[model samples]
Target: MKSNRGRRRDMQIAADNGDRLSKLPNDLLLNILERVGTLDAVRTCILSRQMLKLPTMLSQIVIDLSLRDLVRMNGVVADVTDKILSARSPQITIHKLKVKFLLSPSRCLSIGKSVARAMATQKLDAAEFEILTPRDFQNCTEAYLLLFAAQLNNFLHACPDAFAGLTRLHLQNMRFAELDITNILITCKRLESLCFVECDAGICSVLNVEHARLVEFTIAFGEFKTVELSYLPKLQRMTYNYWPCDDNPLVLGFVPQLSELNLTNAGLSDKTLELSQLLANVHTVRDLYLNFHSEKIWVRPECSWVLAPVLAQLRTVNLDNLPEECDFAWTMFFLEAAQCLEELCFTVWDHKCCRESQKSFSKKTDVKWEPSSIHFKHKNLCKLTIYGFQSDKNFTSYIRRTMKTAVNIQEISLHDRKVCKICAEKFPQMEARPSSYPRTDEEKDSLRKKIAAKPTMVASPAMIHFPS
Candidate 1:
């Protein structure tokens, strides 16, 4: 045992000597240090002389503090920031700092001040500050807004030069009005991607995005009325949403080079022709999504007259719950007009009124229902998906007729509410299947045998497959 202990100590000493002799390159050591957090990277400096210089080579830094850490430690925020700044080399560029402050107003302000101080010395590429609190801003007083504005001013002052090189900006749940956002956009010359969530600003405040390089923009309004998107020249993708408001029409215009457009709950009256008119002007758009949540979405016979010309250029169309009897003639007209149509998606609401109307049509109409008439045959059409299929006699008959007409359709997908056992047994490989159906007898028997063979099987849930 004495001899073994002496041998072990000698081997450890030899390994230490080898490590000291074989020093890693600075670039390689920095790469290893970059994998760790800012705190860990700074901690590594105490390991050895070579590692003491590792933190200085760090180009990227991330700082995250827990809510408890903010409250427990008196000057931890300042101390950490000082250490990071001391270790940062002037040659290092592209610093990313992320701080999560979940504490009282005073503490948050202090942390913000420390971050601002750090930004003054470091060449920060991007700075993200997130405040995760459950405080509702709706009932907030003027005092709260003033405090927020002061904090934001401090943050901005700290990183005055930070935004000069920033190409992407994402601000979420920050209490700000339209004017503040417009000012920020003006300063951010190279801003490419901007996202604003749950921000309220008045209608007259036009969101003028003058950044010529702006590519993607997303804005969500909670209680704002009237939005204009006319000034963005280089904008490519845009998502605009508005809450229900009776005061003004959510106006959307401009973006000539836009390839993708998404509109959710756009407060347009059922009788209004503005939506059709807006669609008419977006001639350069290749992909379009329009979701209407109004109770009345009936399309008049003349709807095709207005919509057909605009939709003719669309490659993809997603229509959600238009009026059930929304002029089938107009539907046919739009389908026929969309010459470049590749994929078609249909979502129907299973309403009692719609079912009753279909029944009434079956009783009164003597005209033969041709399957080919319903089958949308576009030369480019290859894929068709139908949702809300309720496996009723009328629906099944319509499917059969429609399938016969889709000559170019290579793939068909259906999401049925209820599955037919017979159909599941017959067409297991088909793209269309009922949602609820029993597994094959062989599978059931196999599961039963496994359960009987092992008592542990009873403790586990059985696997089941159901089509959607």
Candidate 2:
């Protein structure tokens, strides 16, 4: 019921005092916006003119555009991205910039320009660029090759000095040769972690990664003849997954601090590729993970042939899909050498093919698992776990053998495949049956009952666990 003039004056005073967030400085406002989210902060532009530029103050910018989005937004995504990067204040540094887009020749230029501009102005802690092409690019002929080549060339060349301040960088689907990678590594002097996935390394016969400050590195799905990892004193973690290395051994040198190593699908099925020389320089590694093909021996289990350096400090070891019938040569070798091993895990793949494959392995017949040997005492091994356990006689015997020697063993856990969510989710076809492949439920139940009927063979005070 106040007069109109009085109401106008009150409104003007409120505007002068500023809105709820108007009292905060630009940095504090940006911090609030960052915590609230970029989308919400952008919406605040309607509330006041000052907030129209709030999104540019964000330290982390993630732009993801796909084919579906390109149709609806009609390529406004790139323009908006450029504008956001351009508007960002030079004083405010970007911590992370992750951009994922479907690759196109025109879009590649825009992306390269935006990324280069952003990197030029800000000190990025981490940057990830993912160029995903359509799965059916083979049908497109020369267009596919042209698009990929243009994108890769423009991206790498455009940002020569961009990665100097970056701590972490991830590149996906990039086709770079040895010289290209060396240039990137040289420019990224402070890079701590680097990852390449599905990258084309076909042009390079030998790639040398010698980074002084690099701490962690990963390469997957690459066709490299030889990869030399040298002079990386601070490297702590390394992963080489599905490496189609073309029968070339990895050359390792001067990585004194490398601790954790994962080698999965290493294509080492051939007997000639010995692991001893490959792991000779990595004696300092503590955690090791190896996933070998079911049909082949990634590492030969011949006791007479020394295959690896003794890892005295190895605390954790994880193996996948080990042949159940084979002699525990690898297991025995690790246990004998790794005096400080605290945990051991085996992911058993319970399938009919694995059983059939085990029968063909001739080494199992010659080698005998004699747990009574005086060298079987392992006092440091505390926890042992087996996933996808079918409670087969061979596996149970192996477990019983371990329990007898591990005097200080704390726990022995055997997880059934039927109850394992990961196994069921990964192999839905296998989930139709309860136990071992090609066996009936009644037969499996009988086998389980018979196994359970036996007296618990645990000698030590170790806790024995089985799935309910």
Candidate 3:
């Protein structure tokens, strides 16, 4: 239907576009493919002849079942993994490799042997295996936990080469014996990161770890009574979830390079944890995160002199999950001890789904404490971040006090309550206090003025922000 001139112009425009994408640099195009994931990237190769070679040139491969069509995905892990790995050219060295699959002996053996073959042929920078239990965690029984651990032990024995090359490993819903966990750590000599979800040695057994090359470790919802970081020289970051211990959940050992630590627990029967004793061995920590899980606060507030020795090097602190109505002034104890702290963040929310009553969770109350180091002033604190911030005195007075203490404070970011989609959907009829986050410039200015009008002390001038 078009004329000769029109036909020529259309073809010329298409040519100028260089087949729409074929002219892009190899690295840029590979990055786009990598971000979209390996399986999706392979399908994209059909778009153009130029992209067909991209799959063979990939340096990273990740096959996460959660990212795929998860319906009935339990049994096809072996076939999918073999197809992807077999298609790749062995000459291209993989920089990162991750495969998450369910616990099926035959399928798992096939996956491990395939990875072992790949490791023998090419240089794999890092490899990981995320093994999922046969059923959901809530449906797991004691006998099932023991059976899964034994099967994994046999799997490790069958493919020693693949286990040796792995740099990261994640296991879930397997309860190993005291010696089983120690043996796995020894076999995986090059491991740098390890994660365990609802897996433990026992309910009240002591677990000792001795890894030379391990750098980052995480354990969530484990029943171990006391975990000893016996000897880990290169360890830097550690995340520990709920524990049933009465004292400190971790026993710090020879970890000189440990810099960041995150601890989260729905308080275990109101047991108070003292940082001085728990962090006595590791003093180089620069960042600390503690989540109280919207229940009773478990940390015992200490005086500046008592906690200063260990908290002296701390630069940032995050105190999360405080009940919205409780007094936030109790958090000032960190600024009192960590004289070098540069940033402090807090999140105050009463999770509706976690609540037993409609009003609030403050019935259990927060850790009762008062300021002990009034004369001390923090010169390095530059940022204050608060979620679920309101214009009431509970928050305003706390801000005014912190401003007076943190003489060099530069910014205050106030945000609304973090939305929990699961809670909203599960408890649709539950009531929550209306959010008071400022929606306009006038409201933000008014709240800033109210907190800044301090007469008792010369508060440092700082910019206040209401994050939208």
Candidate 4:
């Protein structure tokens, strides 16, 4: 057996290390608790008498439980969350309170008041609540939605004036009406940022956002007839997943401070879409992104559509889905207009037009890349990136024009579109479809040599990159 003296020495060493942890200042100990995450920190309260009260003093609390845990625990998780929230000391100011939990009608009824009580007591800088939908969203009943909305409304109503100081609020995957949205915004008087994703607005035709302190906003996958931005003077960045092409268009009012705008699935038509009218007052935009779609070609001069306002402040532009069948001049209009543009990117995809037989690469093109204004040359242009490059005539013509006009160009990158691997093996048996894979390095080199030879080339030492 080990000697009694050796056992005493070993115990003394372990005691010294335990004392080091226990003797740490409460502030330093709290920092350690915060870094380990809320759940683990809360469990630390059981370590010793000193740790029992440490969780109550945390500056932030995050209650994150996935759907699997909720289903397996069968409502015990809600009880635990309630206990944790109830145990927090009111004097402790939480900087962030993030809760991501699966929601059901029954769970909402059980834990709604507990969550509201916690929110009302805490002074938070940022708050995010994500209510995950049921796995069978399509089969969800209307009664379930009614209960969920009722619980959420009650929680918002319980929010005290302390919630008004919240700087950011992100709500996702919930069905809320216009009244709920308005009430939440009005309650959070100092909210600077707001984001909503895949939220259903019940029977609401218009989402009128009239906030003074709000700066950034984003929305995706929602049904609303009109989104009216009226009195937002401090708004800076705005992103919409898809351009609003409903019966009524977005109303622009007093966004003089707006700088960046991004929209996916945009249209080039002036008849069905009112994008031109929407951009009338947005003259201060510096960065713009538009990903276009639709099979119909845009008639160039016949349509009489021009991007409103000479974007003197515009610096960066990203254009996607500019296919060969579409009017290439539509893109040229921006390059000619935005004289101060420093960076430009074009992304091509196979979703729009598909063919079986791959066409031979070409460097020569008949179309001219003439600027709308005779004196315009991209003096500030430095970088150009193109994805899904096939060395087609349209792209070759566009690049040739860019090389000639963008005198200060420094870098050019090319990426080929990716094809599904399994589908390629069956290409011979099937009808001709656009190959999803990029060109081989040898093929890319050949195309590069052909095009590099022809651009009565500008003298800048520009490097070309062809990434597989």
Candidate 5:
């Protein structure tokens, strides 16, 4: 039913609109180019003459050179990188550059040299390099390590001025000698954030960051080892997660500006005492997180006495996987010392202390443990959370004692399978309490009835479970 003339006019109008819309602004088109992979972006050049010249507008570059790809392309990979770097006129100012690859020792040296050369000429604000290969790390020989370290050293030395304007840097899965990292830190004087993930070298590395203006530092050691941290003077946040090594306690002497510290899966031997001493010396820390996993550990008792004085300034504390043999007395002493404590999370493992109560009940004995006493007072205590609770008289008594001691307590969260009705009856002034479990409709209705019977100050109970 359509006339040929009408059909042709409609087609012409749609083509005109498509042409107008396809011509995207330079910035918008560059954003689209950045989201695609390098190979895909290169393929876009063949789509049209306009796209042929659009690759130059990219200000961020990511190079992923896998071992298989490298073997397949042979010399083509390096050539492409060289061509890409050369094509940017007036020296492209890259905001970020990321390179990831698996390389042989010889290839690593060549790539490191090439990267150093590029860094020496390019103006980069941030950079990340990751090398992951099982062959390079499988019982690697000392000679191979030295060869890689030497090449990395040359690369770092070549770009001493490149990191002067950098704010972030991440280096992972690379083997570097002690002096290699030391030189990098010394050269990157303005780096504010630095991360070293799974980097290992023989001999404990010493980081001298006194002159560097670093704000955040995170180190995750693949192998159990120690690295010195005594020279960081301006660091604000530090996170350390590593396996235990036989190295001495890492001494942290001049990090006076630090405010937050997180330690996960960290083990301390007699050096635990040294860490306590160092914490006592720090006057600026406001938050501390400790996650311990070992049992029969007397580390806390020894450290608690030394850490008591410093606890006065702490505002928050989180303790996870606390051992059964850990002296609760020392823990209470430390808690009392925290005069301004606002939040507290205490998690015990395996319900060790609660089992004794069960045994006593079966034996028809009236044995009861004394409530943990407080020495210093927490005037600002408002929120308290306890995990791994059991339906035992001992735990109920502990909860009752906490409610009696905390005068300003406003919220309490108990993470347990079930709470004794007597314990809930005793705490009649808590607000905003909730459980971490699902309830049937009937049970939910019953809970609502019970809540209606209670006063507004007494909140409904909540359930919390440990992860499997």
Candidate 6:
């Protein structure tokens, strides 16, 4: 009904109102684009001519393909990386960049060269690379590992600048030579975090790590006789899992600032490792985690005289995957020590799949430990959590003992057992024990009255939770 000029003005107003995102400030537009991934951001700006330059101005760049996408997208990833690096302006500083690609020498050579050129020309704050092997750990043969490691070496050799400025690296499924890993450590001088999954030297080879500025290290499924932390002064957290060793798994020498340690292993052997020998050197550890894989008791409890000094600064202790059939009273050996311990958590789970598939012949042995005679009342322990909680004599007795020991305990949490789908499907014949957790408010109050009426219960007014 209006004239042509008036209709054109209305259409312009509608379009201007619709395209509000582009009119935002440059700083805010960059922030929004960065929150979305770099790949998605570039795709989003395809039709918008005013915002086509935002991708080049982005500070954080991440080009990661999922597990199902690596094979098909490896070449695509290389092409995109090269395009991004070549198109990006050197004036804008890239704060963080990560590119993950399959270990193909040709593709890696292209990507590595682009990143190296960027490092030389632009202001890249930190660069990271996650190199994936062709095959998985189970399917990888020794020859495959050697070939993949050599390909990675070639990539490193081609673009030394990329690795030199890298802050994090995760290598998988490789059996490096004795000096190969040491050389990597020497070359990656600015590395803050490093991880190796299913990687090691030859059989029975000791992995002696010596790094000055490394902060976090993790090794999973490695066949090392002993991984000696020869010198990692600034190390904060270390995790070691499934180290197939009969002797002590780790030997710490000069990890002064180490505060957290995680160890996970499934051992059915009768050999029990002593913590006194394992942790005699590092005393600054504040968080400790040990997982037994619901099999045998692998760690032997030490006397207070031997363990107290080592656990002096320990604040949190998590003991995971204890078999549900075993008694929980033996874990008090740590509670009696650890004067500064604030939180103690325990998980009693029976992983049927892992037990039957991994070590079908190994039996779950009973843990034997007695409380220390030295009278030391704990005042710092305020919380206790139990997973796979059963309303049985073992659980109640353990709770009473903890309540009495920790007089100022603040709260108690009881959680239902964590069920694994694979475990339930594989072991369909095995029936899970029914939990006796109270259902109604009246029943819960009745249990609370009973717990409070018991004479062994402490006078501390602690709250109890039964989470369904």
lDDT of 2 by residue, 1-468 (tens): 999999999999888876867667888887777765344456675588767777887897766555566446425656666778888888887887766655565765676677777777676667766556554333434444445545655655665554555567766555564477787788777788888766644544567889999998998765576778978889999998776654654677889988898887623334434446666777888998887543344654433235335476689999876544444434665676677889999875533333234344343322333223465688999988887666556676666667666667888777765344554565565433446531455655554344334354344322656543
Q: Any runs in candidate 6 off by more than 4 Å, and if so which?
A: 1-18, 356-362, 374-376, 459-462
Model 1's alpha-carbon lDDT is 0.53
Candidate 3 lDDT by residue in tens digits, 379-410:
99999999888777788888888888888898
What would the TM-scores of all predictions be? 0.59, 0.72, 0.90, 0.72, 0.63, 0.92
Where model 1 places Cα greater than 4 Å from the true spot, the runs are 1-154, 172-178, 203-209, 246-253, 266-275, 290-305, 308-313, 317-337, 345-376, 386-406, 415-468
lDDT tens string, model 4, 1-468?
A: 779999999999987877676578899998888887677777766766767777777787676667676566536656666776688877778787665555555664445556567667765556655556554335545565545566567656654343465566666555676588888788878788888765556544577888888899888755565677888899999887643454544677888888888766433334344445666677788888776542222212212125535376788988765543443544656666676788898776534233222331111112223455555577888888887776677676667667777888888887776444544553444443454333676766666665567646663323667766
Predicted candidate 6 versus true structure: per-residue lDDT over 1-468, tens digit per residue: 999999999999988885887888889988888887678888877757888888878899998877568888899889878888889989989899999888888999998899989989999988889889879988998898888878877778788888888888999988887898998898888898999998899778899999998999999987899999999999999999988888867999899999999998887667787777888898999999999888877888878788888889899999999987788877887877688899999998888887735444237567888877735568889999999887677887788778778878889887878889988898888887787766787776766566666776674433777776
Point to the candidate with the largest lDDT: 6
The CA lDDT at 28 in model 1 is 77
Ranking by lDDT: 6, 3, 2, 4, 5, 1
**Residue 395 error, candidate 2, Å:** 2.0
Question: Candidate 4's C-alpha lDDT?
Answer: 0.64
Model 4 lDDT-worst window of ten: 359-368
Task: Assess each prediction's global lDDT (C-alpha) against the native.
Answer: 0.53, 0.65, 0.83, 0.64, 0.56, 0.84
> For model 5, how does the per-residue alpha-carbon lDDT over 1-468 read when each residue is reduced to its tens digit?
789999999999987775552388877877887887555666665565667766655777676666577566534545545556556654667777665554344544454555555566777667655544433445566565555556556655554554544566665556676566766777777787887766655545444445457888887764535556666778888887654464443446678887887775524333343345556557677787766542323234333445556665678777776543333333444455566778777775532232223222122212122323443334677776766554344444454444445556666665654334543454344321344332455544443343224343232333212221
On TM-score, the stronger of 1 and 6 is 6
**How much lDDT does candidate 5 score?**
0.56
Worst 10 residues of 6 by lDDT: 356-365
Clashes of 3: 0
Candidate 1 RMSD computed on C-alpha atoms after optimal superposition onto the true structure: 12.2
Give the TM-score (vs. native) of candidate 6: 0.92
